[model samples]
Target: PGRGRRAGSRRVYGTLEDLLGGDIFSDFFRTFFGDFERAAGRRPGRRAEQELEVTLADAYTGAVKPYDIIGPDGRAHRVEVRIPPGVRDGDVVRVTVPGLGDLSFRAKVRPDPQFERKGDDLYVEVPVKLTTCILGGEVEVPTSTGKLILKIPPGTQNGQVFRLRGQGMPRPENPSQRGDLYARVRVVLPTRLTDRQRALFEELARLETAETYAGAR
Candidate 1:
């Protein structure tokens, strides 16, 4: 009877791995869980937000809310995603959700003008027609022998443009013609950085100043 009890107890008291089911979904396997949130909180002399959420969406894309991550302290946080710009009907977008994962989906951008900000924090409204083709898809170029792929980098800016000759909209009077594609670029900086990293950066600045002083002579 004692032997049977021992076996039952062993089975009941499984390892932490067993409780979590698998390594892929386990805490150890995650790249960044609350790292960003925690870092944000620590820097500003406050706790990382216990309850936080960000929502991104559009009328056509509907609502997409990724899985919420629970901190060790039992706080729930979720990230909300808005529909991507420039995707017409049947177009696909690669959505990245930290901690939870990434996914792709099909959606469309409304024909109405959309307003968004640039890296400099300037806001601008862009017409749908000018941005329709470049959203979520790469522009392809044809050479004499084969083809070339041109990818537009993320965080594109306003008024900046990419010129792909003969890639523009077809003219009504010219059936054999097409228009070029122009894409803008946007750059973003994280709101904060680690203390160690900031110290290193400051050291670099000092070094650069020393070099400049030496060159002046």
Candidate 2:
């Protein structure tokens, strides 16, 4: 059993992996589920919501998630939720209750350790060596699917953002169209510099100082 997390008006059980099923769903899984309802209609007897926590991978590719709800008979009834691709956090999936109105399943997308999602776009911080930032070089960038080589032009500064087209999350409305992935440059400085490196840096510093002095004049 995993820890419970509060979602909206209900408390949900299971860890991120247990609920969303984990990274094994990396393949391009076709979504059979259709668009779900976002708003609920006025009903006389509506059951309290049961929350579901889904992973980014699960949201990326639609998967069937199993859930249990208390039936009006006071028995736990298990149902498999057909999750469509590109489902975002806060989107509710309505489950049909034999007699009691509809049971709501509020989706809570588990936060990714390496990526931050905004709408359909994804943002990631890519670490680039100081030398690579100074001189033109290629750095491997992590995407939802895999790593791609990103060329950092010469004089690329720290915090510089690069957009990789069609790399972000797929839109629920249109699975073929994707937003974009923003790769922010995080310049990593060397903690320990070799004697040769120190000497070269010293020479570069002298050159910069000379250039500044000349500019002042």
Candidate 3:
């Protein structure tokens, strides 16, 4: 019933006691236990380490979609924006680059504007869900400057909102119900960085003697 060796016997030494007493078996067990001990000492997993499932089903009208940012895993990420009054394709939405994060450039998704005007009312279909390339990436943008950059830190959140000042246009008739551009920061870790880049980062970390921006409670 056994393939050359029995459960209670040792194939190499012919007996359990003989195998246990051998130098090779003793060395093997010592090495195995040592590695296991080191592995068991690591920190446990937390909610932040979990993977999130996101979906986008319905198509958006009058929304802008810039070039998708590819994560380290080679996947494109899209951010949804409401088609504010008078927004069209190729219009760059100024976004502030978040500290420790990168900025997202959202371009118009639809080729033609999709808004209906009825008497004194105007309506447009907006995106139900917006995606960000980096998670927890909060942007500080200046719309008037016509220069925006998004800097997403290492840990951004999904569905977190960001606003652009004066970027929204006045409603067609009301002039008060103006629409604003919003973005959600998506977090993604790099699959891997090159050795040279890693070394540079390690060096930069070593040079930091003081805490620069650890938020104060």
Candidate 4:
């Protein structure tokens, strides 16, 4: 009975020594402590992620906006974020905070009413009067930058698209370069016609429907 008791004690001591001397005990404790630290929210220097809402113009022009963040100590602080030009939706911007963890900003660009942006290109619709379409005059068109004077050719048809070179949103890769702007022409007809205008139109219609017009054509 004494030898049996001694053998059991040796086996227990050997098992403990093997556990302590090898990396098994240290690794288990390290993993347990790491999990506990994470669960208890005591991890140091953890990064934070947030979303930032920006306007299309702001994204296009590149702006410095204020960002409010709550630190681990529960104090609110304001930070200035530099939004690069041509930043698109879902793009990430990183900023390092002193003592706090790094902050990541995901850009969310709002839609613009004046322009429809698609892959750096801008599209807009311009309304042109019937007389201007027929007489071929200059019409003011709205672009991403500003108003532009677009020449309307004589007998410009409705739904005609005109391409304005280098007048679009800035390219994300190269802000100095830009894309094109497509302006679709929408002709606006006269709502009410004057008596003299009706009379002249009646005469023109009579001339147009005549058999001689067909023969001439």
lDDT of candidates 1 onward, in order: 0.37, 0.72, 0.34, 0.70
State the displacement of the C-alpha of residue 93, model 3, in Å, after optimal TM-score superposition: 32
Q: What is the lDDT of candidate 3?
A: 0.34
Can you rank all candidates by lDDT, best first?
A: 2, 4, 1, 3
Per-residue lDDT of model 2, residues 1-217, tens digit only? 3323444433354343543443212110111111112222233354334468888888888777876444435444556777778889978788675664555677888998998999999999999999999887999999888899999999887889999999999898998988899999999999998999999989978778564445332
Residue by residue across 27-112, what tens digits does model 3's lDDT show? 22332334333433445431111111111101121333222222333333432333333433333444332221233232322322
lDDT of 2: 0.72
The number of clashing residue pairs in each candidate reads 14, 0, 28, 0
The candidate 1 region of ten consecutive residues with least summed lDDT is 48-57
Query: Candidate 4, residues 35-152: lDDT per residue as tens digits?
Result: 4345335456643235677778888888887654445454545667788988888788887789655657777787888788888888999999988987899999997667999999
Ten-residue stretch with the least lDDT total in model 2 = 26-35
C-alpha TM-score for every candidate: 0.24, 0.74, 0.24, 0.71
1 or 2, greater by TM-score: 2
What lDDT is obtained when candidate 4 is compared to the true structure?
0.70
The Cα RMSD in angstroms, rounded to one decimal, for candidate 4 relative to the true structure is 20.0
- Best by the lDDT measure: 2
